[model samples]
Target: MTLLRHTSKEIKDRSALTINPAKTCQPVGAMYAALGIHGCLPHSHGSQGCCAYHRTMLTRHYKEPVYAGTSSFTEGASVFGGQANLLQAFQNIFEIYDPEVVAVHSTCLSETIGDDMPQIADKAVKEGKVPEGKVVVTASTPSYVGSHVTGFANMVQGMVKGLATKKDKKNGKINVIPGFVEPSDMGEIKRLCKLMDVPIILFPDTDGVLNGPLTGKHKMFPDGGVTVEELRDTANSMGTLALGEWGSSLAAKYLDSTHKVPCQILGLPLGLTATDSFIDALRKMAGKSVPAEISFERGQLVDVMKDYHQYLYRRKVALAGDPDQLIALTEFLVSLDMIPAHIVTGTPGKKFEERIREITKDVPYKVNVKVEGDMFMLHQWIKNDPVDLLIGNTYMKYIARDEDIPLVRHGLPILDRVGHQYFPTVGYKGGLRLLEKILDAILTRKDRDDPETSFELAL
Candidate 1:
């Protein structure tokens, strides 16, 4: 099936509108990145509603308590400035929450008003508002310019700038930035590193925080996230491995320039080739041979791919999500001989289309890829040209139902499903799980559509 059957090959100019965007605003991404740090309170230097929205979405997605502080801006603050409200917020946050660090992220309103965060932080220090050893970091995340991924990148870079130090010699510890994946994905990445005997420092880690077990008490600063001390030690690390160039490499680049930590940017390892590249990189970084356990995992994934080729081969699919995810996912689908007929993402990037085209240049059929595109446009394309499968966030379910097509939930804000918060989709093990889900969706459709006489005992 093809989703853009009626639409012409020639592209048209579009301006002044965006509908059902695949990406979200910046502050939410910054908040998620902040939660990866231990004992750190995320401070929103914007309206109370912005903070509430971010917290609510994160809580819904992760099914855990999401905590953040707001400056509680009013019309007065919006007009003149938010410096006063922020100063008060710092004092109250320290006195009430008492977190060891406060990560401040700016909003569109604050950025538009030109509030200097460093100046206000300095004032708070001079006025004795901040504790003696408490750390305060700021990230300029204006919501208007970029998507949530951009905000996440900005805050991560802020952490490197605000916390990392160079007091000791090179400690030979590798820095691994896992990108804006799930808490479960982060855990799996750490497990893989441990298996390779590689000592790594993973920042913005949210394993225990977002996926914490119920302990009969709610802790504002959950015992998850990167510790302040660990972040300070990142400067002494041997090198950096940044997964997903767009979402996870910004901080690595900053560290490389400022602290002399060599950085390697790689795609999120979602398929066989990508995962092999990731493992190879890890082996080189650790200066160790590939472990038997890791090799066995990779073999298992390949075995599943061979077994499921009958169902996946030649199946048409449409995918939408963040940039890096879409890139790796596209590679995975292509590896299965599945045609990614139509691809779309709300994040604005000139290189996204180019990279995707480069990967699909040899495919048999025409592959449509769009950057800064919305789901509405995708839906319209699907209306004109339908696909056998639709893979994306929960919002894509509506289109699936209307089009009578099978849908596979694959990206963020999966509001209506489970397992995403627990299972990973990065390493070889994750690849098997993703394959299972895709086969389940496609085979279920086949069983439902095939006639009773045509149905066989074996799949």
Candidate 2:
């Protein structure tokens, strides 16, 4: 079969550059995720605008304060260095926020100006600007190298490298590295672990911190996360499980190097195949059988799969989102017998491409995959070949509306909807959520086309 390609006019270089960019500026989302950890203060080492934009976006999506620090770079600071700005900010945050940990990430401007954040942060640490037992971790996530996904990965690496302690052995413990997933998903993962009777350490947890309920007053740091203790304990884990490709590298590498703990990289637990891999990994590492409760949940997911087979079979979908988001969604789509007619991600990586190819190999039709491609290209191909639904961030909202297709918001930002990060979309519970969204989109589109008077209630 021949694959249809978009013309330059259909996807022009400039106009097609990005009708709506699917991803956000790097450091913000990374900061948002980090803040979910209990007592973490995410510091943006750049201009105030970057920090403001990032905080505003998170607040809009999550309805939280989304606290963070800005270097407040001015003309003098930009050229000379942001050392002073960061030093002041560091002192201010520790004094004010008084969190146990501060996570520092670079913005585009700081990266362009060549600010030495590690040296600056180190100065703060050495001079006692940072308090006792309080830690500061730095990540060089220049936005130009990639998208928010890259920054998230870099920040994860930074956490493991900076905070994890050396020389220890901890039994009945496993390390879980969940990628850029929703806070609700993180909560469900923890819940499942508890039901399985497995002891584990989860990093960068945001379940309550990111999706906290309002009690009238704004908080600088929400009280939920992996804790500084968990970050330090990663090296001592019996084994490490990397959730997705992006956020798993650093911890896995560190554990291997320092603690000699084995690391297993698995896909986001979105579908049956990936979720099974996650549970099985845990069971083996713990030397325990699959708990009855988890087994029943799996059986229920299979029951729904049987029920939704006809509704999902042979459907075509357009997917555009973060790499981990797109990959997990694609895997889930295929499991339901949906064809991802087009897959697009802003972040460019070989593993992203290879994973897509591997997941779709068993499908009957050839699947189209594109990484590092913009939404303009995605829109062009969607026009070239019709699809049943679109799954991704709000950037695809306009395109889906124009084409009269249904769209489901999943992944970072989810600007068009509230509580996406708060809602669960992983494991068996998350699988059911995926099933509901897919069915809703498909049914909604069908209802629109069916004659108003002639449409039947029963399929």
Candidate 3:
């Protein structure tokens, strides 16, 4: 409660100030996106600290080895230019690391100085620093302009632009942009695609790369990741499914415009309705039926909802996370007849604000929504209008404790939890798990607050 001493319950306009940001910087997202590409080395084209911080954060979140290269900018590079540093990095990376692709992303320093990565890359290739047949892609990811999600989208678009090729023949394969979701969520999506019998090409797949096994040796480029071949064939796919407009739509839109591959933007498959939409989209795109197995999974989730609706009905809640996650999570909470009294995201966009407003319009209680916002504002809202449950990343735990509210961890950087790393939260099974966690939090609170005389074992 006292973590932010300067914060107050009174909501005021502070045009330039942002505290406890819900989203991280851009280069981190770029690094994560690069991990999804097979034999692709993520190179940070800025100060070494930026790369170090990104690698640390990603490593902590996934509890796995995150391998990335850096331009290792110095004072001279910062004052003059980083082109020489990057060119040298390219030579060293190609010669030593020997990755098939180098996914380069810019930082605040490079972008501020207007470093032309493309030109530098071209020079490197011409100077014979870049090996033939190897690839070098770049994304303009200034930390000042957009959040990590935007960086992820930009890097993915860069990957497509650099690697995807239009062939004469069209393949039945469907391209899936999984967005900035967990490795587990990516794996779950692949599972759902397989069950639907859809020949899908999921880009930036960090399945085994980010969530790899405890092998004796560490692989710089993990076994998991969309291969170069897969990326090349993406342009020849029948269509593309981009989940989460904020984190994925840009790349999908780019692919559509450039390659004539039609694109459909869908929310992350979280709740029953969202999952249904995803399944329906798959069915239509694949020209096939939803397999009975998938239906059974849906049925199981519905069964859980039916059994637990009483526990969750009309429960007031507060939520904070990325835009795509907030949208899907809000929808899921609303489906349970839960009041998402407060919602916030640090990622700035009119679209995010509009979507949130549109979602909460029908709610009985007033919903406090903010974009380009901070956690301090969310905490102030919670202080003013206390909620029964707080749902967000582990950062919300501080507020939950001070307010004595139950909390369900449901977003990125879940530093303290284990399941968010390995368990699925994107499909029917994911819905079931979400329902279970919410119920567990609510009921545990109920049990803790109930009078001793009125406490019933069954209830």
Candidate 4:
């Protein structure tokens, strides 16, 4: 008997319900973004349970201890509004934790009750709850509104609105918003910039904060993240590069409108063409030529792809993740002559579906794509039309097991796996890693299913 035996191949309409959602709540993304700020403690302006769920999700995903303060709203606060709870939380967080910044985000409970976060934050500042030089930034992240990707965008924009200020003198630096990626990916983006000899200030940089090395002594705040000064100096930079439209464009647009910073929005650099675009953008913006080292890495990625073309060509793949990731991954799969048979993202955006279809338009087979869809739908598609490989988070494992397909975990809430927090999947180097994973999954399956007599000693 199969686990998903009850699932029907016939696709049905589902508007009011979502089964096994691919995305988490807003507060989780907000807390993750807040942690990217140096010495910043995220505060959830809602019930303690909400904060706990958010923290637990992030902790499991990153395999790190995530700290966050909660308003701890009781029945009384729920009816009367959570302003008092938020104010008290601010006072306690400052006095006890003593962080340099308190990043606050609203939840469904607080938002539904009509609590004004900015007003309460201002009151906290007026009452001296926040000490001198310490900042209190707030983002309206109602869990009912959007997915975690939206929450990340809101919090990043809030950070810019609250801290970034234009100075008379330019810093000759560029601002790079790396989007909602892993800490290792952020580190890779920074390394690429350094190789290009371009000065960049990457905000919400979790490279050192989330992926820190363990030591004998434990510290509440790690030696990573973009500093408060760096956030402020974003306004003085030459230009801004927003890596992903969903996770980073909001903050970049804010800076452009308020501080006259030029902004360019691009997709996440998941493969060859996208990486080239990123490097080209950096080269043009910083007035520098592409470094020989960077060119060599690109050549190596191309060479490897050519060498392994037989393994990846025309392979059918199913993908589910955030919109930004799906867009880039779909294009990459098409480039490798792989059919992206089924694609789904829980985030609601028509542009996501449109972009996916556009990428797969020239493919030989019809593609199944959905925006704001659930894992159940993806499983149904797989049951009706099976793919050779599955690329998604841990949730896809059940489908993989039932369908007998190879799995390549690549998105958020990757609870069962590690190394994504340490290794990148974004740059040219990351592209190589992704290619290696894909080939390994495909070839390993081939080895398993093929007869022993027909097996070759070497490729």
Q: Which number leads on lDDT?
A: 4
List TM-scores for all candidates, in order.
0.96, 0.94, 0.98, 0.99
Give me the runs in candidate 1 sitting further than 4 Å from their true place: 1-13
Report per-prediction Cα RMSD to one decimal. Answer: 2.8, 3.5, 1.3, 0.9
Top TM-score hit: 4
Q: What order do you get sorting by TM-score, best first?
A: 4, 3, 1, 2
User: Lowest-lDDT window of 10 residues in candidate 3?
Assistant: 1-10
Q: Once all C-alphas are superposed, what RMSD does model 2 give against the true structure?
A: 3.5
Cα lDDT tens digits, model 1, 1-115, are: 5433443434456697776789998899999999999998999999999999999999989898899999999999999999999999999999999999999999999999999
Q: How far is candidate 4 from the true structure (C-alpha RMSD, Å)?
A: 0.9
Whichever of 1 and 3 has more TM-score, that candidate is 3
List the global CA lDDT of all models: 0.89, 0.80, 0.90, 0.92
Model 4 TM-score (2 dp): 0.99
lDDT of 3 by residue, 65-162 (tens): 88899999899999999999999999999999999999999999999989999899999999999999998999999999879988999999989988
Candidate 2 stretches with Cα past 4 Å from truth are 1-19, 452-454
Give me the runs in candidate 3 sitting further than 4 Å from their true place. 1-6
Model 1: number of clashes? 2
Give the C-alpha miss distance for residue 64 in model 2, angstroms. Answer: 1.5
lDDT of 3 at 254: 86
Error of 4 at 8 (Å): 2.3
Model 4 residue 58 distance off true place after TM-score fit, in angstroms: 0.9
Q: Which parts of model 4 are misplaced by more than 4 Å?
A: none
